[model samples]
Target: MARKHLVTHPSTAMMIRDTKAAEVAVLEHHERLDGSGYPRGLASADITPMGPILLLAEAFAYWDQLKVTLSPGTAKALADSAFAFADSCLLALQKALIDASPHTTPAPG
Candidate 1:
């Protein structure tokens, strides 16, 4: 079966083959900075870089939802709080992307 097709049905895939990546992602999902994470209970340093990025993305999405009922500033504030928990490297990369983004307004003439 194709990867995309299998992904559409998680249970079927689980019954059919090993779910190593899924298991690892789940382990990483509940991971924390205080060594309270699940599966292996990996801490901040123990978790890989990808874990924090996932956590940040989840926070940002939830923040966007909060924006629906709150002010834009409030939403941005929530997003910033989410960013605060991320690795500095991720924040720097995000800043670089924002600085270099084509959607950024050009300098005034």
Candidate 2:
């Protein structure tokens, strides 16, 4: 509700709505691994384009959060442990697809 209220006008809403439309193609899956449906009831499919990836990123971030900087062994260890937790969340299957890349977009070539 609050999120909706934030963009209670046209310009912002149209952009968000259209972006979601484009995202539909990317998120155009529904069949939950446990058997579900689409739209307002989506699960696995919702996670396809960006949802699952978000989860993975958050998990890695959880690890990254353990330290202030990405330095030597400590940083790497935190990452490893965070990923280990992310792995556990996916129960191994989903872990393989996870990416450890930063959330920021890459610069142009």
Candidate 3:
């Protein structure tokens, strides 16, 4: 899928003091934990922390906008589905981070 909106990354980064992080977040926000998302197909480990947050916010805004055109029940269902997908991706990303963390040895009592 050609995501034309991805071009906003550089423009957004140029306006922010934290250019790199902002750029990465914008670029990675569409990525999924299962590598099923667009532009890069990056997995959980590859995505930045802000990526998931942006994805969730975008999903909410999208569904919220659709509420105007869709029936209440349909809108609610779509919102729930979007939230579920975001939750699943977040959980997978959390798990990936946990798995990648270095184990620390406790001090002897």
Best-fitting candidate, scored by lDDT: 3
lDDT tens string, model 1, 45-65? 778765656565665555444
Give candidate 2 misplaced runs (Cα > 4 Å). Answer: 1-18, 21-47, 67-109
lDDT of 2 by residue, 1-109 (tens): 5224223333443566566643543342322322243334455434444434443454446654542233345434633542322224444323332343244578999
Arrange candidates by TM-score, descending. Answer: 3, 1, 2
What is the overall TM-score of model 2 with all chains considered together? 0.28
Q: Who wins the TM-score comparison?
A: 3
Task: Score candidate 2 by lDDT.
Answer: 0.40
Residue pairs with clashing backbones, model 1:
none
The lDDT for every candidate, in the order shown, is 0.51, 0.40, 0.63
> Model 3 reaches what TM-score against the true structure?
0.57
Error of 2 at 52 (Å): 0.1
**Residue 57, candidate 3: C-alpha displacement in angstroms:** 1.0
Per-residue lDDT of candidate 3, residues 1-109 (tens digit):
3588899666967799988888888888877777777679888677777887777667545544443233445444633652334545445434443454444576899
